[model samples]
Target chain A: MNTTQTEWNLARRQIVGNAASIGFAVAMYGVSFGALGTTAGLSIPQTMALSLLMFTGASQFTLVSTLASGGTALTAVIASWLMGTRNAAYSMRMTPILKTSGPGRLVAVQLTIDESTAMGLAQDEEAFEGRASRLAFWATGLSVYLLWNLATFIGAVSVSAIGDPKSFGLDAAIAAGLFALVWPQIKSRTDLSVAFGGALIALALTPVVPPGVPVLAAAIVAIIVGWVTGRKLS
Target chain B: MMWFAVLAGAAGCYALKYVGSIIPAHILEQPIVKRIVLLLPISLLSALVAVQTFATSQSLTLDARVPALAAATVALRFKTPFILVVLIAAVTAAALRYFGLAA
Candidate 1:
């Protein structure tokens, strides 16, 4: 191991706080998702179903927001499925590292989310040896999974008493939640271009297109941005 | 309708992950394919935010969501953290509506 005694201590500290911290943060996100689900007119069971099955924060948010705006179920599903495509990208890096297979592959796939992937990859970058990376992945993933679901249940039931979700400003809160999710990802000018370009397209098309179709149509912005700006990364 | 979206959407997303697991890495790692996959969510999520904040039905309207998002931007600019940004936006919108200023 290339790690020093001090480095081991530091890594130990990180291991202690890292997954728990990430899990707490994601629990907050899950609470918002739960509230958003209910405010968007989903029943409690439906809300829980999305949390348990859909699992991905961005995809779940897309479905709730699309439906809230009167998009058909098909559009809602497509938009969420589109959002979840990023998970596929992450899984590209994750597949070989995790080396999961058979029935265990199913379990691994559930944890193949943004936080777990990021944590796992960070450890892999730190130590080329796979042990630390795998540990980080499971610890972070399981903590996030347990806390996120529990918080969602709490948020859903708590908000059930509110009258007129708009009066509570949940609509704006939902948008803000989406914004927060993307803000951290916008670490570069090109990333900003893609995000802003996509927002412009969606806003422009919102009036002309059907409620959900604009979201789907906005997919072209990323395609064009990647072609012009990001194509060199073979 | 509810179960259809929940179950089918989950299935679709899970399928994407499962596909990546089984697919040849060389194919999935193709530059253009990789680039687009990385960029796709950024665009779609930003687009969704726009639609949620501005659009109501077939028309774009100015409302509390606008100011609320603006509040969130300020909070983000200050590094106020994610939960606070969300809370700020909600509270801003709620305050405005409570005062009968914006719906």
Candidate 2:
């Protein structure tokens, strides 16, 4: 019993440490979102609603950026939806591991995001009975949700004091945050090639296409690269 | 119209999550689907970075974001903390703009 208690304590500490770091990092980016969202003409309440309901960073940013560029509502929604689709893939990957049901399943789905999924899957291999993984998921999800919303409120309220957010380069912070998120994922030659190719396509199309269209068009590059590479491997 | 878009977006996002929950594990685990899933974020995020950094009001223009993003790339290469990466990028761009070096 004593050893079991010790193990539980160790697992709790480990999970909390990981969750805290990721949650804080994510919350900082939420500030950038809040400032930019309001500058993009979203009311403070609207910005908060996006953070609360959509609760996905990249999708929320895509929605606001689309709107900022005078894209039609339909176009903004479509762009946001495309980005949100990734959460579906995340949910598919997580549901089996979580094995939730009924109301629990619904709640779990709401908390599903890239950070939580990554934290859950990153548990120490030697931890027993899945305790660490479960704790990591719940802790990271809850903390990030709480901190991100709080940061958003703070940022929105303080936007006036900060003057033009762009003057402070807060607008560029979004891309920087995104770049940091994607940095650790590019581990292979294929990943590097695909990323560069997609970025180039988007850049080339930006001047010619509508605001949100280039992003959608770049997905074609990803599909072709994945298909061609997969065929070659087979 | 904005409210309508937000509500529709919320509903669509919810549907995506719910649909993922209902799909069979074997189907989602297929090799082709898995490969696409893995590659999707890399491509999509890179595209997003490009659009957000370089595009403005339906047009592409060079600006302080270029140098700021370059600084961010260096910070990321050194494995700086994520928050620091953003701060470095922001400060770099802000300084450039303040000095009349970039719009």
Q: What does candidate 2's lDDT look like per residue over A122-203, in tens digits?
A: 8863476777777888899998999999888887777756677888887788789778867888999989987888788888
Expressed as tens digits, the lDDT of each residue in B21-71 for candidate 1 is: 777788766777767777888998899899989999879999999999999
User: Once superposed on the true structure, which residue ranges of model 1 sit more than 4 Å away at CA?
Assistant: A1-16, A125-129
lDDT of 1 by residue, A34-73 (tens): 8998988889899998888778888999998898887889
Q: Which ten residues in a row have the lowest lDDT in candidate 2 chain B?
A: B28-37
Candidate 2: where is the Cα deviation over 4 Å? A124-128, A232-234
In terms of DockQ, the best-performing candidate is 1
True-structure lDDT of candidate 2: 0.81
A180 in model 2: Cα distance from truth in Å?
2.3
lDDT of 1: 0.86
- Model 1 residue A168 CA deviation (Å) reads 0.8
DockQ by candidate, in order? 0.78, 0.62
Looking at candidate 1 chain A, the ten consecutive residues that score lowest on lDDT are: A124-133
The TM-score that candidate 2 achieves is 0.90
